[model samples]
Target: MNIAQLSGRGVEITDPLREYVDEKLSRLDRFHDQITSARVTLTVRDVKNAARRNRVEVQINVPNGIIRAEESNADMYAAIDKASDVLERQLRKFKTKFLKQRHEAQPQPEPGPAEQAAQLGEEDGEVQPEIVRQKRFELRPMTPQDAVFQMEALGHDFYVFKNMGTDSCGVVYRRKDGHYGLIEPK
Candidate 1:
């Protein structure tokens, strides 16, 4: 377990509030033991609207990925509780997903050249300066429409696929304007 960093936008982080948040988030370690660190941010937004002014956001760093949860409520304590609940739910879901991925059957892409290079680098203990993380999966062929559906279904901001019609690599991404954009190799 780690102490959460307490920060406030318009409100002061009193000792009691800090202790409360730390106590609440410490329970998360029970859900996911691999959590390395956690950062919490508390904000008082819209001072006039006390009904939904208190906002709490928590970010946890784990070995595989980072988990984040945010909640807003009338009271700071309530917000903290809600955020912790959300994080617990997310952590549980992540655990379920990895366990399922291990036993369940799913389509997977073959290793590409990049994966080969990464494997070689690991074998040789040579550091690759540019690449921080590398993920290898089968590039399934799909249409732009299908890519958009897949991206939304996965709850990701972007998705990459092999364009079936164009026979090129393409990316479909959610845009800031609540729209989808497609990028294809020219």
Candidate 2:
């Protein structure tokens, strides 16, 4: 397993704390051996309220995609524990989905038309409903701030727009904390 990069914001990282984080994250290798890299950030928010002051965020890069988990608590150690638990659950889910997709992608014997249709409607042993509606819109070029404004005007949680700076597709969304987040291609 690759050693994770650990950083702190508004707090000093001690040797014991670093060792604890390394020991906790190392166990993730049992779930997926292909974890390319991991980044862990510990933050201590300077807020008046002491509850949920410490935050732990972990981002793991794998072959298929990235898995992330964030948790906050009054104690940094508790926050780290919660974040690791969330990561474990997400890694298990990702592994199961990857295995299922690999199994489904294998060559199969030709089936009758009805059987093919049935198979198309069922994936992972669950029936999938067809699309009932569709919408088309122009992706106007705008800055992330403008996209966030447009999303709020349209009463949408997310909006896809062409980024003015990068000249590429981007997404702006409202986070649960009433802040905005932007997503762009690497």
The candidate that wins on TM-score is: 1
lDDT agreement with native, every candidate: 0.72, 0.74
The C-alpha RMSD of each candidate to the native structure, in angstroms, is 13.0, 15.5
Q: Write candidate 2's Cα lDDT for 26-104 as tens digits.
A: 8899999999999999999977765549999887877635677889988999888998888888788778766775777
Task: Count backbone overlaps in model 1.
Answer: 1
lDDT of 1 at 61: 67
For model 1, name the residue pairs that clash: 109-138
Writing each residue's lDDT as its tens digit, candidate 1 over 103-150 gives 866534322222122222244457556777897755777666656655
Error of 2 at 158 (Å): 6.7
- Top-lDDT structure, candidate number: 2
Over 4 Å off in model 1, which ranges? Answer: 47-52, 103-107, 110-156, 159-186
| Residue pairs with clashing backbones, model 2 | none
Q: TM-score each candidate.
A: 0.58, 0.57
